[model samples]
Target: MQTFRTEIENPVVEKDIIDLANKIELFHKGKIDEEKFRSLRLARGVYGQRQEGVQMIRIKLPYGKVKSNQLRRVSDVSDEYSRGRLHITTRQDIQIHYVDLNRTPELWAELEKDDVTLREACGNTVRNITASELAGIDINEPFDVSPYADAMFRFFLRNPICQEMGRKFKVSFSSSDDDTGLSYMHDLGFIAKIENGVRGFKVMIGGGLGSQPREADVLYDFIPTDKIIPTMEGVVRVFDRYGERKSRAKARMKFLIKDVGLDAFIELVEAEQNAIELKTVAIDADVYPVSKPVSVEAPQVAIKDQKAFELWKSTNLIPQKQDGYVAIGIKVLLGDFYTDKARLLADLVEKYAAGEIRLSLRQNIVIPFVKEDLVPFFYTELEKLGLVEVGYNKAVDITACPGTDTCNLGIASSTGIADELERVLKAEYPQYLTKDDLVIKISGCMNACGQHNMANIGFQGMSVRTPDKLVAPALQVLLGGENLKNGKGAFADKVVKVPSKRGPEALRRILNDFEANANGKTFYEYYQVTGERYFYDLLNDLQDVTNLTQDDFIDWGTNEEYVKEIGVGECAGVVIDLIATLFFESEEKIENATVSFDNKVYSSAIYHAYSSMVNSAKALLIAENKSTNTHAGIISQFDELFVESGKINLGVSFSELIYQINKNAPTEAFASKYIESANLFLDKVRTYRSPKPLKGAK
Candidate 1:
């Protein structure tokens, strides 16, 4: 592990890697529990793959922005530590697979040399902060959201409050009313808006897609940019304290808002105001770095296929707000590209275009700041890399998850079927090459990693069994999903389930029917007119399993017999409410509070101290085998079980002591007093939990 220490410049990041290395050793020595160890590794972005003895390292890229050097660093790391393949995710993260768990620390250390990180990329902590790839150049955007998104990622990277939350939280920033960021499906969605010459965002909270999809409700129509960070901090605090903790399925922020009602949830967030460090922290948007293309004369290149060049140019080039500049969309097939192509692409962008690339939410790449006259030159250069395919963000550009390829949660082959469907579109529906209205996304499971439920046509991987007990890979066809635009949208409805082998046939029938009968209507508009039942009935015959074939028993991309095996997903860390662990965490919180106090961040210090007290009380409550689902519940129960019942006295009630955080100003005086109160309360609770001696004991 010391081998990486000399390579990493940031001491803080170096310590994180060292800590993970030490924990892994401790876990191997049987000093740490599997659940706790799993959480630790996951927060560092080391995920267990479907196959045993390897890991998937998710490299976090804020808003999908990667410098040319950073891209080369990742490629080098991939070549050194794992396979040469890089997989871009729907959240704008890059994942490299089939890595040995023991070498992750070294792998991370190498990536950090170029200022790239994997922290909080795969865990319950705020998963990669995603935004529109066209953010800085979008003609419809009021202001660039890149800086604000960066601020959020930096603020919460290792914040004490969200280190071990019940579920993962996702945040996205839409560049414009186009809602290209898909604001409707994130835990907290921010759409860029300017009102009265003031920059702000239209906030949407609690929207998510899973086994049960829920659309987020409008939180604020327009909130000033300065308030976004503070608002998010308060909201996360409320969630950490009151969000569901027992059942994994109900642990998402979406479920919490649903159970308590959005109004009540907002009230809780408002109550956390006094505990936030900065009330209106303004993000310095000007400091946000954006790369400009090198001013180079375009080199003439001969185009062998003029027809193909025009087709590619027509669909792949997006107009930029900057004059004489355009953004080129490279439709990365299934978001997979090798290290060789990666290094070449990095060099090409650095020489002619911007020295940076934005990974799109649709699992593609956008090279912004390309000069309009250099389109042909770029096409020829990219053609050498086999990246000049047409129909980027069009019907041919299908978004898909790894599915059975690697993801532990995948039940069927999403990538395999996605390849087939894309082939079908290119071969049969060539007319769709110029159409951008249709969206297709796929996921291996109900987790919606592929953003399936947000597409015009979606497919979810599943399994179906014949009467003879033979199981075959299947797909849950979802329809009628619409982007809706302007911070509003609808999730797709599950219309039908068909054998994986017939997935192409299902797409063909759906498209054929839509084209022949819709009379130029968009997919979503036609779906509304025809309704869910109408489509369900149209594809109902494909659901029959009685007439099974040998091919149906085998999953796509595999020649072996299909076997349904799903390992546990480490997307959300497990609940580890061990009494000793809780007490240990309380002390850690106190230490953090003291550190914050020294830094003069009084509000943060106060909140940390308050958390120490709550956790201490919760430790005692757990010792008594009492339920501690939410922090609000824990406070009420602590008072009832100890203070109110006169078992332990601290002059005043626990409610008054804990509630002081919200009632008083976040001054140095109040913060110090509150921390003292927390320390005293913890001492009392510690004594109470100490094993008492019997009469006439030694």
Candidate 2:
């Protein structure tokens, strides 16, 4: 029941924030304060991200769709609170940033005025439930899952069980293979298909987000729509009872399914589903009222401008499963809006567009029902609003998480890096897009806030050093990640670890490599055929440095690693931040961190509870003989975290340590000291955060 303005990262000036939340709880007497509880909703995020001045606010819009008024309110919140920027996420939710700490309560109040809610936006809560954007309009839809998504959203909002679930639960629904929703990578993905002449959902269990993503296992071949609620209750109950509670790393439903087999997990879900009372199912579609239409004039098309209309035709519209209607794709750069512009957009869509508008997963708004004739006029009005940019599906559109700016869990300025990279790419290498879709995604931390693990070429911002001896935030290129419905998680293969400034050029170089080797196919298909090795060799040719002279890096993995991976697809890249950080000056080097050619070093928060991937990345490989007992308190403190790169194995061979030492010229304690200091540095990071793009990265 924390207020919208109050978060773990916000400076708790008075106990008022805490007292207020407790008061809210009392008022509810356990039930959600359906009306005045707007401020108490948004609980999404890890703590490390918000220590910086920047704030991330997630809005819950069920079924990946929203109304014109709701959309306007989102834009108003952006203009009023944030720096007029929104990041449309892979999840259907909208995340706004650059919010002032004091103004957050006001922002929440404003959102409530428009009937918008930020509840269930973060934390271990059931995040905004999502369904295919075309749910209501798509004729192929088995049964509109919008109601189900709506039902779940209403059923769980502020429900204590889901509000503090062991882990975040992402639910997505799609109809058939024209899957706009990435059903495979969700905690629960429901795809509509016909079985036995009955349209029903193929329930999928345990899929999720990460570098180690798992596709959901089928829980039911086809669960009828009526059974959907009961089925979901079963799954939640299973997670509630058996999901790993102690280890955050093992808390996601995917881990539970992986540990106890999908079959057994389904059995648990079935047991729970069987217990739900259908007669008392908690839902009133009329009360929750999703989206309805208003009459509008037929759209007007300008016949005078063929070229403008042609561009509009190419990027503005998408095929609706319905023959008479089409869905318009309105490109939203960084998903931002002004209050006036929001109002105008809403009016424009309401007057000329079919009353329905949807918020796309790409962080853009969609006008679902624009007529064929009004194409040109809509384009003109849209241009007047300055929202007619046609580069969204292209590289100019890069989704980013609000890094160090506001979230307590952030490690770097994810959005800042993404914005810079996207700008550089659009100006420097626009041709890369003409070659084919080169999705460049960026995240602030290992929490995968930006969904970097799902893009074709993703970048997670981290502080890294260059060969020239300077520390700054940089991006690590991930290759070949996509949602494969057949089977397999998207893989973001490890490629080049470069300074953020060089990301654009590196992106261009990689695309050029893809073009030269692509033969004649999409970049993805080419990478699929050529393999990671081909891309690695190309990167080897472009490598700017060959050696490091300091003890600042904690290098992990074998010497012959994939310097740059090709198209190895989802959940690739061995977590090597620790090993990468330890390669510096023997005596003065920073420990548990890596130094680049520029003398910049990278290390993670030692006490970063949310960072399991980076904490013990090197420890998992080095043998017990080489391992120093890290936690030797009066009480036994077994290192609960182990970060092993699936690509590298740390065998019991101290002899192999010889191979690792750039040269064993110094005692191992020399390396150990740096690691110890780095750990302390990490511990301190949790308390302090630089504003997003605040000072220099170093």
Candidate 3:
């Protein structure tokens, strides 16, 4: 383990890995609180799997861009640390399961060698910043959004402001109006737009997909590219200050914007402008290194089946803006691929294409910069690796999460049923291999990890009881959702709940009805016309649980009777308010303030000091069982309970003391005063809490 510490070049990253190792040791020795430890590990990208005792490591890949060297490195790490399998996530992250908890530090250290990271890949921090897979090469895009996405990802990788917000915040960059990145469902979404000969983006804020989906509101019709980073900073600061924290279910930015009108939220965001670190952080769109295809003569290869080759070429190849080059889409089954094929693919890309790959939002892979003339050679090589699948984003292509396979929140086997559905689609509807309009997604639960709520046809894992008091696996069938292009989309409507075994039948009935009476209209168009009630009436009989047989008791991909068990979900943001932890955090914040002050970042220093005071007050408030839902709430509550009640003397209202941060300009004098004030405030809170006995004090 010390060897890993010595191997890391960056001292900060080395410290992070060492700290994680120490924390894991403490946790294993029963020297740390389990819940608190879970939060620490989760923020580092180590997640608890459903199988227990093993971990799922999420490798953060910014905007799904992976160079061949990085892919080879990841494949090597996966083979050494876990099984030789990598699962691409809906957020364009790569995850490896069944990893020993102790090896995570080494695993993360190994990834850093290739400039890949696992930091902020999970937990309450900003997750991987995703963008359209074809961001750089999209012909319709106003400009490439890859560099902007990369800049944001870099800015917030270890930024303290969003390290522990009310909940996780998701951001996305769409290449064009097509919204291929699914901007409508993210917390903050940016669509590329050119306004008045300037590179800008159509900004959307406060949208999210979960148990409750909310469409984002238009924050700005267009904002200059230089301003997006600063605007995002203000939005995050506002959410951290005013967003919900007590109730995990309602803690997202969407709920906050919904509760307080978007106008009020905008006002709060605007108020954060003065405190932002950078007013205009410029990202040169060309920062993303352009790659040229390796010069390789077209290899002579014979197509075994001409019709199969034609089908694959027509459906899987996407034309790139670059003349004479094409992007090949590989339909990854359930986003799972083995290390053997991965290394081979990496070799293929490095030898012939641009030495890189883009993981699609559809949980597939796109190999760009492949010459059209070399398509036959590439296809033959891919065929050997089993990477030549016909359906890229077609009807036969389905998106699903790990579900009961690994995720703790999984209620049913999403992968199992997705496998079955894909099987049925290939076997029964061969024509769908080229049909790209329909989307079918599955989630083991309502978390929408599979984006089920935004799919043309969706299935949510659930359970139902029979008349005999026997519980069986079930799925809530949803329909009529699609991306309407240009940042607009619809959420699916739950039409019926049926046994898991009957999911195929429900799909059969829906497709049969659609084909018979659709009158040449698209799936979404027909769904919009017929409405939810019509679909419900058609599939209503399948919801009957009384007619279940013995097989219904068993879930798909299992040989034994189904037992519904859901573990604690890690996506719920965590907070700790132990007196010691609070004091420790305040000290760390003071150190951060000092560092910022030394670096001449007065605004950052002032905010860090302000956060320290709020954290110290929050410690006392939690001691008194006061609500700490938001930073604003904490300030007011601290004033009401501590200052006014004379329990702790600050000589003035806590609000007045802390609110000075916003009232005064951030200067050398204010930074000094604020740092002193935060120090005194933390000391006072500690003194007041020292004599009091807390119920769960460790």
Best by TM-score: 3
User: Residue 257: error of model 2 in Å?
Assistant: 1.0
Clashing pairs in 1: none
Residues 1-698, candidate 3: write the lDDT tens digits.
23346398898788888889988887888766787788888899999989878999999999999999999999999999999999999999999999999999999989999999999898888999999999888888888888899989988877777877888999999999999988888899999999889999998988888889988899989999999988998898888888888888999999999999999888888887776656799888775677778888999999999999999999999989988899999999999999999999999999999999999898999999999999999999999999998999999999999998898898888999999999998999888888998899999999999999999999999999998899999999999888987789899999999999999999999988988999989899999899999999999999999899999988988888998999898975477657667767788889889988998878778878988998888888887887788999999988888889899888989988988876677788989999999989887887788856333332
Worst 10 residues of 1 by lDDT: 689-698
lDDT of 1 by residue, 1-698 (tens): 23335367787788888888888887888767788788888999999899899999999999999989999999999999998999999889999999999899889988889989988987778899999999898878877888999998999887767777778989999989888888888899999998999989999999999988888889999999999988898888888888877778998999999899989999989888876757899888888776677999999999999999998999999999999999999999999999999999999999999899999999999999999989999999999999989999999899999999998999999999999999999899999888999999999999889989989999999999898888899999999898888878888999999999989988988998999999989999999999899988889999999997998988888998899999998777775677777676677788889988999988778878988998889889888988888778889999999998999998998999898877887899998998888888877887788755322122
How many clashes (backbone N, Cα, C below 3 Å) per candidate? 0, 69, 0
Overall lDDT per candidate, in order of appearance: 0.89, 0.56, 0.89
Using all chains and alpha carbons, the TM-scores for the candidates as numbered come to 0.96, 0.68, 0.97
RMSD of each: 2.7, 17.3, 2.0
Q: Candidate 2 has what TM-score?
A: 0.68
Off by over 4 Å in 3: 1-4, 599-604, 664-669, 691-698
| Candidate 1: segments with Cα more than 4 A from true spot | 1-6, 692-698
